[model samples]
Target: MKKGTELSGLINKVKESPKTLQKISPIKPTKDETQFSFWIEKMLLKDFKLIAIKEDISLKDLITKCIKEYIKEK
Candidate 1:
């Protein structure tokens, strides 16, 4: 019975962790973005990630910039 009570107390503390974390860092505003996924060569993705890191931008941002430029040229 004592062990069961201690387990329930631990569970309650675990459930409260998210609230504590939210107080420390409020959630960011939602971005106008959606998930996009496609198959690419393994080495190509590795190179792309390296470029994105060097540019200090996200992979999605780099891809979006490229696509927008292509559309503008067309």
Candidate 2:
């Protein structure tokens, strides 16, 4: 079968099964914590990841530690 034909069939199947697309509740973070998303320079992200790996900690933990230290200094 052709690519367009396959895609059209898939779309038709999805259209026929409207109930398949069920609404889901947003995931709640534990302990009232929230998730954050942001963009950064590629080089900066790469360096940050390397630092996190070297410290054997998660990226989130490393960021949180840095932010806490920064706030304390201020």
Candidate 3:
């Protein structure tokens, strides 16, 4: 009876792990998710340049803004 209860507890732990991990994700992009444009372009960089030039904001300020938004989305 003890062995059977132990096995059931192990199965329950396995099932709960996926939901418990929802808040955790890698900081870097994954291998299979890669695309060609992901290498050639970055939205943060482009938006930083465009907003900096158009708004007369400093590049550093625009970059900080973009990074904050990116992290928020993640």
Candidate 4:
């Protein structure tokens, strides 16, 4: 198939399959919190994500809770 034909086919499939598309809600920041970004080791991040999934909490919430606990301990 030509490139344009292949692209149209994929587009039609997506248009016909609404169930395959998921709606993503935007995350709202708390009044006291602002955006913060940092880098972590790849393995560590993967482990944290797994823990969050197992706990049934969002990764952002898990990280926030961990930071609060560390601050309380110190």
lDDT by residue for model 4 (14-71), tens: 8884675678999787677788999899999999999999999999999999999999
**Candidate 3 per-residue C-alpha lDDT over 38-71 given as tens digits, one digit per residue, 9 for 90 to 100:** 2425776786689899999997667567769999
The lDDT of each candidate is 0.89, 0.89, 0.74, 0.92
TM-score of each: 0.54, 0.57, 0.34, 0.58
User: Which one wins on lDDT?
Assistant: 4
Quote the lDDT for 70 in model 3: 100
Write model 1 residue lDDT over 1-74, tens digit each, in one string: 99999999999998874644334667665997777789999998899899999999999988899899999999
Steric collisions counted per model? 0, 0, 0, 0
Q: Write the per-residue lDDT of candidate 2 for residues 1-74, one digit (tens) a residue.
A: 69999999999998884565677899766776677899989998898899999999998899889889999999
Clashing residue pairs in candidate 1 are none
Clashing pairs in 2: none
Measured with C-alpha atoms, the lDDT of residue 16 in candidate 2 is 89
List CA RMSD, all candidates. Answer: 8.3, 10.0, 13.7, 11.9
- lDDT over C-alpha atoms for residue 9 of model 1: 97
**Clash count (model 2, backbone only):** 0
Q: Give model 3's TM-score versus the native structure.
A: 0.34
Query: Which of 1 and 4 is the better model by lDDT?
Result: 4
Clashing pairs in model 3? none
Best by TM-score: 4
Order of candidate numbers by TM-score, starting with the best: 4, 2, 1, 3
